[model samples]
Target: MSELIGRLIQPRQPAFWFMVVLNALSMVLAWLAQKPELTLTVSLLIAAFALGNAALGAFFAWQLIRRPAK
Candidate 1:
């Protein structure tokens, strides 16, 4: 619904988007490396990074929502 979409698009701390960009760049570099081992390592690292970021973002949003209105 619109509520979910709004939450997703709402701006938050800058670190979230920075990590996303970093992960994307990492993926591109991995694809272009042309080495099987390096690509595999980078892919795994990027996946871990993405999952961690998601968890962090969820925690931050939950905290924000739970804060009492001032």
Candidate 2:
């Protein structure tokens, strides 16, 4: 049971875990900004932020998944 718990909480890499946190925060920010009445400029800015977050998350995840040389 302890082993299982540890595995669940432990991240494979520290950088990946940090990215996960950042991604979560970005998602929350995007959610908060999701408003139909917002002006085009604000909406565009929010969209850009969201896209940048997603791209960074993807890149970090990719780097984590790719095995490095021995």
Candidate 3:
């Protein structure tokens, strides 16, 4: 629905998208290097970052939803 789309594409959401892109690029570079240990480490870090970003976005959405209407 349009409402769900609005919630996802809100102004503050760009930071999360940026983080995702950066992590994805790092993952690709790590993969290209062919180092198992480094790849694993980067993967774990990206997972953590993703979780954090999700939490942050959820918190922001909740705040936006709860704000009294103008």
Question: Evaluated with TM-score, which candidate comes out highest?
Answer: 2
Q: State the lDDT of candidate 3 residue by residue for 1-70, as single tens digits.
A: 6565555454555544654565566555445445565566676676666556556656655654444322
**Cα-based lDDT at residue 28, candidate 2:** 73
Ten contiguous residues with the weakest lDDT in model 3: 61-70
Q: What is the lDDT of residue 57 in candidate 2?
A: 79
Between candidates 1 and 2, the TM-score winner = 2
What TM value does model 3 have? 0.46
Pairwise lDDT winner, candidates 1 and 2:
2
Best first by TM-score, ranked: 2, 3, 1
Model 2, span 1-70: residue lDDT tens: 6543343343766756866876886787588568888887887888788778878876766665553412
- Pairwise lDDT winner, candidates 1 and 3: 3
lDDT leaderboard ranking = 2, 3, 1
Superposed Cα deviation of residue 29, candidate 1 (Å): 11
Cα shift from native, residue 36, model 3 (Å): 9.5
Superior by TM-score: candidate 1 or candidate 3? 3
Residues 1-70 of candidate 1 have per-residue lDDT tens digits of 6554444443464544554565565555545455565666776775666566556656655543444322
CA displacement after TM-score superposition, residue 69 of candidate 2 (Å): 12
TM-score of 1: 0.45
Query: What are the candidates' C-alpha RMSDs?
Result: 5.3, 5.4, 5.9
